[model samples]
Target: MAIEVASLPLPASADPSKFVDFGKEVKGIDPGNLTDDQFKEIQELLYKHDALLFRDCSLSPEQQYALTKRFDPASENYGHGNNKTGSTVKSILHPDLKTIPRVPQVQLIGNGTVYNHEGLATANLKHPSHTTFHKTQVSQIDEDAGITRYYRWHIDAALYDLSPPKVTTLYGIHVPHGKRQTIRYDDGTGDELEVPLGTTAFVSGKTMFDLLSPELKSLAVRTKVKYAPHPYVWMAPARAMPTGLGIESEGRELPLEELPPWEESKLKVLPVLWKNPVTGNLHFQVHPCGVMELLVEPLPQGAKREGALYPDGAHLTDIKEVRELLYKMQRPAIAPSLVYPHDWKEKDLVLFHNRGVLHSVVGAFTKEQVRAFHQCNLAASDDPTGPTADDIKKYA
Candidate 1:
C-alpha cells in the first residue's frame, strides 16, 4: 500500500482564554479544579504541539506518576530492576568510570563529564529492565582537550531489533548559558533546523520506517532481531562515522563488547514506516544512535567487489558518498514542519504519544550545567488494530 504524507498544521495565534474553557475533563485526568472544557483545551494543545510543557508543576514523584497515567493507564512509577541501583535515584559521574549501572527500562545518555551535565533520560516501554546493553559516555567529544562535536543523528530503541518505540519524552531540569541549540531535519530533505529549549515536537514514525527496503526486512525477520525483520532489508544512504554498516544478515548477534570502537559512534536508525493500530495515523522518527550507512544497492550477479562476499548480493554505499549524504541530511535546510522546540526549565512535566511522533535532544550546551528529569512508560493492550489476544498467545 502506498503511504500518503500528511502536512503539519501551523500553531494558531490566539489568546489562551479563547480556546480553553478550564472546566472540561481531559480523557482520563481529574485535575480537581480544572473544568471539562479546560481539560479539552489542554488536550487540543498537546495534539497540536505533539508535546506540552508545564512550568512550576511542583509535582511529587507520586503526582508525576498520576500525570503520566492520564496518558497511559499502565504507566509505572519507578525504574525497573535491570536499571543500575545507584544510577536510578542518584547520578553517576564520568571521567574513566566504567561499569555504570544499566537500567532495563531507562537509559542514561550524554557527554558524561559529570554527574549532572545535560544527561538524557530514556525508557523502553515495550520491554523494561534494570540493565541496558548500551553505555553512557563522552567519548565522541573530548572536553579536557576542549573538543566539542555532536553525535550522529538516529533514533533510540533501535538496538532491541524489535519494532521501534512509539513515543518518548524529555523533561528539562536545567538549561545552561551558551548551550541552547539542538538540530533536526526532515527525511531526504537537507533543510537546516534548530530546536530551542522548553518546546517539544511530534515526529512521524512512518517517515522513519519508510526508509527500509525489502532486503533489510528479510534480515530483520530472519534474525528475529525485531527492527529489520530480515537480512534482505535495505535502507537509503545516511550519514555516520566510518564506512556504512548494514545489519549484514539474520542469525548473528552483535554483542556490545565485541563491536568495533567506531560502532559506538554510529547513529541508530529504525524502520521509517508504521501503521498506528488505533487512530491509524502515520509517524516518522529519526533516532540518533549506531547508524552507519543509508543508501544501499544490490550487487550484480557474478560480480567481484571489495566488500562483497557473494555474487548477486547486497552491498553498502562507499564511505565518501555516505559521509557526503549524511552531512547534507544534517544541514538545517530540511527541517520538518512537524517538529516543536521547547525551552528547558526546572520542575517541568511534559507528555506526548511515542507511537505518534519523533523527538530529539538539542545539543551545543555546556557540560558544567545540569539537566535532569525522570520518565515512565505506559503499555496498552487495547490497540484498535493490534493482534488479537489469541494470535499473540499463539505466537508466544
Candidate 2:
C-alpha cells in the first residue's frame, strides 16, 4: 500500500514570497491494511514533509497503535497517556463521565464538559451567535478551562514530562462548524468571517532559526538554552496577537521553584540549534516560553551535549533578552506563509514532527464544544536530545 498522504492545501490567498508547500512529494495515503514496507515508506515521507495529513482513514485503535509502534518500536502503548492503565484515545465528551471506554488504551478527550445532556455541543448556540459571546465572556470560559491560567505555548514534552515525544498522531473524531463573526476594529471598522474552528496552528523551529538575523542565528546556534521542566498545572500567557478566534499562549516561563517539587525537574540545557537525526536539517530547538536561563557559551571539550546534557555555564544570557528574541524569532515562523492550522476533517489522522514544529489549538472549544481527536506520541527514535554541541559551534 503506497500511502497517498497530501500536504495541506495551500491557503487560497497566500502571498507567493511566504508560503511553500513542503509536503508536495506526498500523495493521499490509503493504508487499507499497512504492510511493513508501506510503514517504512510512510516513515520516509513523514521525515521528508515534517507533516502529513491522512483523510477519512477510518483506522481503529488497535490499528492506530500498530502504526505508531511501526514508527517507533519503543513508543509507549499506555492508554490515554496514563502509564498505569495504558489506555486508548477515545471520543469521550467529558472526564466526569464514569463510563469507561472498552479499550484500555482508548481515552476520551475534547469539550465534553460543555456538551448538553444528549451529548451534543450546543453551548455556543445557547448564547445565540458567537458575536454576542464577546471577548469578556469567551475569556471567562477560556480562563475556567485554564487557558488563561494553565495552557501555554510549548513542546508537549516540555509541558508535561522531561523527554520529548518524537511523532504525534492526531485523529479528528468530530469537528465543529465555525460560527459567523463580525470583529469590530480599533478604527471603528469591522470585519466579517466564519471563525476557524478546532484548527491547530504550527510554527517550525527550523524555519524560525533560518529567519533569525545572522548575528542572532549565530548566537542561537552557539548558545545553550536551559529549559526548566514545566509544571503540571501550567499557567497560560496571553498572546500578543490573535490567531483566528482562539487565544495564543505567548510570553515568558512561569517560576517553577514555587510549584511542587515533583512538578519540577532539574533544568536542562540544549543546544539552541538542533539537527534532525532523520532528515539532517538543523532546527531552532529552544522553546520561547520554557527557557529559564541561557548558557551563552559553547560546549566543553569532549562533552556530551545531545538530549540537552551539559554542564552549567558561567556566562548567562538575560532571561528577558532570550524571551524577547524568542518571540521575535517565532513571529516569522508563524507568518501567514509559514503558519498552517490543521483544518481537520472527520477521521483525518495527522502525523507531525513534535520536535520540529510549535502548534496551538484554534477556534473556541474552551469547555463546551465537541471536537475529538485520538492522539498518540512516540518517544524519539534517534538522538532525542538533538545535534551535537560541536555541530552548533561549527555552524556558529
Candidate 3:
C-alpha cells in the first residue's frame, strides 16, 4: 500500500494558506524497512513538506542511521564528528549528546538514567536548559509556575570543516508526560507561547525568507555568512539572549587567540540562503549564534539600486552589527503564529530537512521525568547550493 500523507494539526494563529503543505504525518508504512520505491516517495515528500512524522514506529538505531544516510549517500560521520563533542568538554554541546558505540552516527539523548540502551550499560543524560547558557533565565518560582524558554535556535551542523547535514532523524523511545508550559520571549514585545512539555519547536526557513520585504529579500539573496572557527568552543564562554534567538554581544566570547587551534583556510563561509534541491526555493539558513561576519555582494548590473541595502559590495566584521543584522532578518519568523512545536509521543519518529528549518528544544523536565531518544544526522558530502546569476538578477 502507498503511504498515507495528511497535514499535521496547526495552531489557530497559523496561516492555513502558508502551511497548507509544510508538515505531514505519514502512515501505512514501516520506516525501519522501506522498499526502494517507498524510499523515493518519502524523499519527495520530505523535500516538499520539510518535516515528516511517523507515529508508533519501532525504529532501531541502525535503521535510523541507514535512513538518514540515504539522503546523503556519501556521508559517513556524525553531524559534529564521531565522539568529537565528548573531547571538546568546553563546547556548549558537550552535555547534550552521548554517542552510541555501535552506531557512532546516532546519538543517545534526553534526561535521566537509561539502562542497557543499545551498547550503553547505564547512561545518565542531562536535558540542556537555557539557565546554563542564557544571559538571564526565568526564576525557579516562575518555572514552577510553568514559565520556560527555548534553549536555542539552530541548524545541526559542525559549522566548521563539514558541510551541513541534509536531514535529521529523531526517534522518541521513551516519552514522559507532564504539565504544559509557557515560553516567555522576554525580549520586551511580550510574546508568549503555550507549549507541550519537552516539545521540539520549529520555524520554517522558507517562511523566514518569504516574510521579508522585497528589499530584505534582495539583500538576503546577495549575502554570505562567515562562521567563527570551532564556533561551539568559541561561544562557550558567551551567553545567549533571553529570547534564545542568538548570542548577546557582551564581549564574553573566548578570544580567537584562546580558541582551540584553528586554520584561516578551514573557516566556513556559506551563503545566507540555501536553495532547496527538489523544490528550487531558497531558504534563509544561517546559524545566527555562530555567524561572525557578512559578505554582501553588489546588486547585479542593470538592476534597480534605489532603496537597496548595501548596493555596493561590502564586508561587515563588527560582531554587534553582524548579529543585529541577522536578528532583524530572522526574528520575525519565530513569532508564535509561525512556530511549530511538535508534541512528541513514544515510538514516534520525526524527519526534518536540516537545511530548511531552525528548531529548538523547548520547556524543561524535572530530574525524575525521564525521556529517551535517538537522533541521527550526518555531515553532508557536499556544500549547499547558492543562488544562481538569474536568481540574483530577478531578486535584485
Estimate TM-scores for all models.
0.46, 0.70, 0.99
Worst 10 residues of 3 by lDDT: 12-21
TM-score, candidate 1, is: 0.46
lDDT of 1 by residue, 248-310 (tens): 122233433333232322222333233354434333332322333443323333333444322
- lDDT of candidate 3 over 299-382, digit per residue (tens): 988878899999997899999999999999999999988889898999999999999999999888998999999999999999
Q: Candidate 1, after superposition: displacement of residue 40 in Å?
A: 8.0
Each prediction's RMSD over C-alphas, in Å, is 12.7, 7.9, 0.9
Candidate number with greatest lDDT:
3
Find the 10 residues in a row with the least total lDDT in model 1.
124-133
C-alpha lDDT score of every prediction, in listed order: 0.33, 0.50, 0.93
Using TM-score as the measure, name the better of candidate 1 and candidate 2: 2
| TM-score for candidate 3, residues paired by index | 0.99
Arrange candidates, best lDDT first.
Answer: 3, 2, 1
lDDT of 2 by residue, 175-262 (tens): 6665422122211123212224555656676777778775566566557676655322222222322322222234323455544344
Number of the top candidate by TM-score? 3
Instruction: Say which prediction, candidate 1 or candidate 3, comes out ahead on lDDT.
Output: 3
